[model samples]
Target: MSVWPAYAEIRFADYGEDFDPSVERTEMERGVPKQRLLNTDVLQTIEASVQFRSAQAVEDFERWYFIDVKRIGWFSMEHPRTGEPINARFRNGRIGRLQPLNTLFRFAKRDLVIEYVRAPQ
Candidate 1:
């Protein structure tokens, strides 16, 4: 699996835990309502902002993202909070537009949202 670039420094911008539970609702003989919840785990998604300090780094990221991942493949990156590698895919299969901090392209930044593919074992 492809790993995140070492040159790119990821900063956690937002973290969200998503929960969608299966619910069953039934009416009792006495006209009472009952609800049952299914067992499930909360999935996680991370919105991270990364900065590329040099033009070469930005170019490398573009190549990695577009060529290596093809924009829809799974990759591994260290979690900012847990500091463990996590399998993830691009959320909506896209990254936000990269913004250059200067005309010389010495620095750039972009935001990314990735969803966890599985829980850590």
Candidate 2:
């Protein structure tokens, strides 16, 4: 498989209500600070804790990125503890850092936002 960009952003449509201050900080800090989250070109998978609307959106995202979800498998999982579906990025290139399920603030809508932290490097 051709290596793609290491980092990408995924937004879960239904995070609803509960918001994490830390995530908000990271999301907002994408390109502002010297060390920005957007500067995350070394990671392989960036998982967004959230809920998605339909499987079609997931498939679409995979197609857009040229990634095979079936091969990629469950990029993210439905949180067992929380019951919300989790969307994530995986394979290829970066650090292994994940937010705790509890730490994940919910988004409103229905789709999950995920980012690939690293690409085949």
Candidate 3:
């Protein structure tokens, strides 16, 4: 049985990496800056957005997101650009709707942001 929903129909709009800093900065003596690390035990949270171009893709994601009328828990996701599998969950419960001005291609698209953290070792 699959632990998570499959999104094979969804195509990634673009590939890129996003970095989230998890650090605390403090001023030390003489206006010097001192950095205190927080959540060092886990890898920095990776933020990424996925875009769905087709209605079918959006439908698939909507079903998955609204499954059982609850937000899905953390699941495994393979980074679209790096191909590195990381545990992640949807950053928000809702997906953003987008429509282009081109009337020739009236298809709407959706964007979903996901936040990834270090998977259990």
Candidate number achieving the greatest lDDT relative to the actual structure: 1
Per-residue lDDT of model 2, residues 1-121, tens digit only: 3332222233443233222222123334456633224342443223344332444433444463445454343354444335555454444422233333322222222133334333222
Per-residue alpha-carbon lDDT of candidate 1 for residues 42-119, written as tens digits (9 for 90 to 100): 347777788889999999998999998889998888877778888888888888889887877898888877777443
lDDT of 3 at 23: 73
Flag regions of model 2 displaced more than 4 Å. Answer: 1-47, 67-121
- On TM-score, the leading prediction is 1
Q: What is the TM-score of each candidate against the true structure?
A: 0.75, 0.21, 0.64
- Select the stronger candidate by lDDT from 1 and 3: 1
- lDDT of model 3 at residue 32? 77
| Root mean square deviation (Cα) for candidate 2 | 14.9
Worst 10 residues of 2 by lDDT: 15-24
Report lDDT (CA) for all predictions: 0.78, 0.36, 0.54
* lDDT accuracy of residue 106 in candidate 3: 36
RMSD of each: 3.7, 14.9, 4.1
Q: Any idea what lDDT model 1 has?
A: 0.78
- Looking at candidate 3, what is the lDDT of residue 111? 52
Judge candidate 3 at residue 118 and give its lDDT: 52
